[model samples]
Target: MVQRFTISLDAELAATLDGYMVKRGASNRSEAIRDLIRNALTLNHTDKSNNCVAVVSYVYDHHERQLGSRLIKHHHEHHDLAVSTLHVHIDHHHCLEMTVLRGPGEAVRRLAEATLAERGVQFGHVNLIPLKEHGGHHQHDDGANHVHQRPAL
Candidate 1:
């Protein structure tokens, strides 16, 4: 079901919204407004205990003392939260690492913070996506039970 409502925007704000819609390729005002609202809610609704999946990415000096070992230790410390990592050698001196993590929001954020705070780390960023777990377990045609998680939006 869809709910309909009326909103009033000033001329300046309405024009800006139209520009935004054009930049984002929104089909119409309603679509653009829906996307904006979803983004706002997602940003504000994530609490410490909320379940989330995050990607933490950064570039670091590969040869900086024991930076590599420390990075490994950080991941090991939060082994359960870490799903996978991709390492790319940017050059002889720098490497890029992107790690995917899933767990409680607080824990994921802490891990990303620690990793990004390391001495040699630079350009660190984390994208956290809140998730909602489907109620209980279900079985697919394969006869295996599993749980599903979808983006909170």
Candidate 2:
């Protein structure tokens, strides 16, 4: 069921919201507002124990005194949480690494923080999306079973 409510916004704020709607490709103000509210609520209400997927990305100097080895060891230490990693050579001295992590929110956050805290890491960011398992597990025609996870709306 959907509920409707009315809100009053200042002219300036309304104009800003219009611009935001255009930039975000929202079809209407209601759609834009719904997306904004959902994002705010998700960020504020997520719990540490909730299952989530995160993308942790950072740039670092490859020559930073054993930093490459240390990063590999760190990921290995949390192997269960790591889903995949993409490494890019930014230049002769710098490299970009993006790792996809899935597990409890707390564990994902801790790994992201540890990676970003490395001495020469820079431009670090973590995008965490809380998820809920759907329909537990199901078997396919091939008899493979798996669980589906979707963002917690």
Candidate 3:
């Protein structure tokens, strides 16, 4: 079911929304507003107990003493939270790393912060999306094959 509500916005705000709608390729104000609301709500989520998946990306100087080893050690310390990592050599001295993590929101955030706080880390960002609703899961005949239903929009 969908509920409708009316909102009042100043002319400047309305124009800004229109501009954003064009930039983001939204079909109309309704679609753009819905997306904006969803994004804002997701960002405001503060429940530490929530289960979530996150991508933590950072760029650093690989030449920094023991930085690589330290990052590895940190990941090892929280092995359960990490799903996988992709590393790229950006240049002679710099490397980019993106770690996919899944676990409690608190743990994921802590690990991301620790990794980003490393001495050589230059640019870092963590994007987290909570798994609020779990769709039904199914097991295949092989037992190794598992599938999950898609979340409803």
Candidate 4:
């Protein structure tokens, strides 16, 4: 069942939303508003611990003495949290790395911070998203569907 609640938008906010609706090719304001609300909910959910995946991006000087090894060790220390990592040779001196981590929000954020704080690292940022929760004690059932049933809006 859909519950109707009035949301009063000021003129400026309403105009900006209209522009977003046009640019994004949303069918109507209702759809756009629904999408925005869903996005907000997802972000809010992911911002909490125990339910987040993060992409941590940083730039560092690979030539820094032992920094590369230290970084590797750090990731290894949290091997359970890391999903994968992508490294790029941005230049002769600087390298760019993006590490994807899946774990509690705090742990992933800590890992990103520790890696970025190492000597010669710069531009570190972590973008996190909340995924489907898997906190139950269910065994691997190959045939059982595990889709979560969200409440009807």
lDDT of 1 by residue, 102-141 (tens): 8888888888889999999977988878887557677989
Residue lDDT tens for model 4, 67-145: 8899899999999888798999999999999999877777777787788888889678767676665443333458664
Instruction: Score every model by TM-score.
Output: 0.76, 0.80, 0.80, 0.64
User: In model 3, how large is the Cα lDDT of residue 120?
Assistant: 96
- Give lDDT per model, in order: 0.88, 0.87, 0.88, 0.78
Candidate 1, residue 11: the lDDT equals: 100
Clashing pairs in 2: none
Instruction: Estimate the overall C-alpha local distance difference test score of candidate 2.
Output: 0.87
Candidate 4: segments with Cα more than 4 A from true spot:
1-15, 22-25, 30-49, 134-153
Q: Give the distance in Å from residue 85's predicted Cα in candidate 2 to where it truly belongs.
A: 0.8
User: Candidate 4's error at 53, in angstroms?
Assistant: 1.4
In order of TM-score, best first, we have 2, 3, 1, 4
- Please tell me which model should have the higher TM-score, number 1 or number 2: 2
Better of 2 and 4 by TM-score: 2
Q: What lDDT does candidate 2 reach at residue 137?
A: 79
After the best TM-score superposition of candidate 3, give how far the Cα of residue 96 lies from its true spot, in angstroms.
1.2
lDDT of 3 by residue, 1-153 (tens): 999999999999999999999999999999999989988887666578788888999999999999999999999999999889999999999999999988877888889899999999999988878786566666677786555653322
Q: Which pairs in model 3 have colliding backbones? A: none
